[model samples]
Target: MKLTPIGPAALVLALSAATLSACGGGGGGGGAGGTDAPADYVDGATFTLGLSSDPGNLDPLMGAGSALFAVTQFAYDPLVSVDGKTGEIGSQLATDWTVDDTTVSLTLADDITCADGADLTATDVADSLNFVADPENQSPFLGTFLPVGAKAKGDDATGTVTLTLASPSPFVLNGLGSLPIVCPSGMDDRSSLAKATSGTGPYELTEAAPGDHYTYTLREGYTWGPGGAGTDQKGLPAQVVVKVVENETTAANLLLSGGLNAAQIAGPDGDRLEKSGLSAAETTGLVGEQWYNHADGRVTSDPDVRMALTQALDLSELADVVTSGRGGPATTLAVNEPVACPGDSVSGALPAHDPDAAASLLDAAGWQEGGDGVRTKDGQRLEVTFLYQNNLGSSGDAAAELAVQQWKAIGVDATAKSQNETTLTGTIFGAGDWDVAWVSLNVGSPDQLVPFLSGPAAPDGTNFSAIDDDDYQAGVDQAMGMTGTDSCDTWLDAEALLVQKADIVPFANNTVRTFAKDAEFETPGQLVPLSIRMVAK
Candidate 1:
């Protein structure tokens, strides 16, 4: 499950370190019908979901929004489906799979058909894999869901798809489990995917309006759902409407009014809903992270400057500010479930906050404190730009401002700016005018971070940070040989090495909560569409 970016400040700019107080008052009812649902609830009814942001693109490969990922599951099926809570692998399009070093083979299910009514063959599966595997495709999942340079070959007669990796992958099955397979038509026409979908999943995209709402209809005879959930299941909403309602207050109101069946609410609004007897499913992941720009010409390119900038702030305070004091210390990049690696990489691994040490580090690096207390080296001010996503809510904005002030105290001029996810991604990966950024990329495995952490800079790769860590690379290489829980220790070691170098700082981990209003669904991060069961209403 992917996390919707989260961060701290109140809806207002008060830097109060107060833990969240209880809700102002209880909501309108004894919950959306207590233990028993309304008698009118039907399996074919529409389930309306309220989302905080629009999933701009419907394409599973391109979209980063947690909503998009959840909705994608409704339309597309992975070769293997993983249990969101447990690290258990289940069948979807592929009934079985096996791995031997660099070679991973999968047995495709023969009964599956695309939304277009075309048979979903092993060759189509291979094409989908190869498409994302090709660097020319420029998929963000190139090194994420599927390793770049990996080749796929399908045997049409035998219903088998073989993935030959360029290198041994540590959590290859986990990667495959997250990959959403596309049919030939969707693979051939990329633009169509933004508006429509073609895959063998529980639902088919019936309508989409980009930033407004999307409607999906259940596909009949979809027995290959994650853990064998089928369209024939009782209480399954026949039509799912994913509506974009950015304001949490408005969403909470909708939930109370029965205009929506489910919504993910955080912060104060969540507290209010809980008091009203609404139950929430909580999923915890890193939501506050600091990444230094390693691109040439950026002040953060200097290692000492990066270290100094990182050490300048009291991280615990920053975490509190970002989470509105509702978060814990981040432990690992593998925050999403079923987490491929389970270990604490933050506790003693990340650098502690020390302004004095930061100032001394800058001084030793030839940056002298100027008249205004800002540092200067070679006539250039020790200035850096901090970019973050505005959708991370007010808390993120406050945290960014707080970080800027902290940097200032350390004689570093830091500018904080917030952009929408699209603009933020462009600025970090395309515009390349950033010095540092607060971007939390939550993936299931440490290997999923490889392309983003170390490799060619983006446009070509997701390595927006431009990291080149020999130790991290060595650790990843060693981890690839091990599988499942066996690779956890090595993956943690690799992650720790990156943190030790101050390449990135993941500070806050929050239990992001989603409130269900007349619909029952489990949230690993986003509401599982197939898991949704409309209560009788």
Candidate 2:
């Protein structure tokens, strides 16, 4: 598949880190009449999902969670959309889009209407995007895409709308496809999203009680749907209900007991689930991670020491604990999943890990093995501290901790610091103060990784390891300038360079899989879920 240079965020940010503590406390009461068949025309049956955390927000812009996106498949509509099955661009709200030598114009669907019953148009799209892009709003994700004041004016000639870009941004299609249209009603640049539910997608949000459950029903008489509704043997669920049940073990148990339709089981449990009368489907998980923070200064800056450090840890052990051997070992930030950096697969001059070679390099760099067998240079001990967060959710801490064991076996003094949410988020990530911290970032797509690992991204600029390389930066910039197949090749080359330099360590390409019993819209393995593929059973 041809990947876009500018991809979606790594999917990890959308992961469920907290549970529905309050819940308005809905009873996991069995559905009335317990019929296997749903009582709706589209969805065969209303399915109940056990999510790892509560819905972060109903606001589309601030919302996080793979399940939230699953529900939003109904509420909002983007100008361009991808095919869930093939990652191909299919029409939804936009009937067609045209690109000039520099400018791009999008044609909106005539059938477009919001849940508030407002007719969606180009004006709404422009207004909503501007709201998120405004400096005052301070949207966390705004920096990932077009910069502030990026989306310029749009003109409506008769019935069609044309949009102009600030510059020749090749990622325009990527930006437009993900930016959704919002209603102008009760909206301002600094308005609070108390009950902001105005979108033009498959389903309308009936109700959402934060820290509780979310209920969404199909939009009646909806004509604009993605792909065919369903196959002869398959049907879309009439309704999609998501409730937060944080315990991974509980998620697995409920799935086995048949009380829950499908649940995302992590690590060892996933293995048990696959073997226990359950089917498996995975998306390329967005969680990109690495060990970093030499700024605190314990000599992680030494190239040979850093290389040796990376070589010491065994990924197979990490994978065994984190994914239960379900996914492959991650070697670079951008794995070969949809939305991966086009540069991730590019050709490079980096060498793969060789323990013997690592030891040789360390020795050559003056790391003389001491009495304790620990390499020491200038009387400094070869050691580092690793930090991570995911107290409530799966952070693969077990794997990271076991990696501590592996490094120790390799004669390296490494300690794993599994932190509490406040400490991890506040001290490590928030303060940028640490020795070597381990963290995972899931951007719905690999393109999302460009900003996280790429240097000097707008606003917050997260190139956490502070790996500032001119050649590597140029490669990423070149990829950003590309739109089609060449973009992929450029990104692949950049990825190779990153691997060679050991800028970031890859652990595993998240399979993006979640277990579901109902199979409402049983899509093949994918990273981002397109609103178009959702069917009404």
Model 1 gets an lDDT of: 0.74
lDDT of 2 by residue, 1-537 (tens): 111001112122344211111000121222211224333323245656665545344566643223444444456666776543345666667677777746666666665667667777677777777766665664434534443345544444433555555545545565455555666663543243434366666566677776557776666545544432211222344555676775667777887776666565555666677776565445554243454553435567676777776676665555555655556555445442334343344123334546777788788988878788676889888777776544223536667677677666556777667653223433443434455655555432344455455554223334445566677778766866667555766766776677666666655555544665534233322222221122232
The lDDT of each candidate is: 0.74, 0.52
TM-score of 1: 0.90
Measured by TM-score, the strongest candidate is: 1
Residue pairs in clash, model 1: 7-395, 7-396, 8-322, 8-395, 8-396, 9-395, 38-536, 41-536
Residue 310, model 2: lDDT of 69
Over 4 Å off in model 1, which ranges? 1-3, 7-41, 65-67
- Cα lDDT tens digits, model 1, 1-537, are 243444211000000111111111122222221344335445678988876656666787765445567577788888987776676788878888998988999998768888898998889999999888887767777777787679999999999999999888777888787788998889889899988998887889999987789999988988777756567766678899988877767888888778888776655677778788777666676777788888778888899999998899889998887777888889997676566778898777899889999999999999999999888999999888888766556677788888998999989888888875545666666747889887777676777777777888866666777888899989888987776678889889888988988988888887776676766666553445666666654
lDDT score at residue 373, model 2, on the 0-100 scale: 66
- Candidate 1's displacement at residue 292, Å, is 1.2
User: What does the lDDT read for residue 231 in candidate 1?
Assistant: 77
Candidate 2, position 260, lDDT: 68
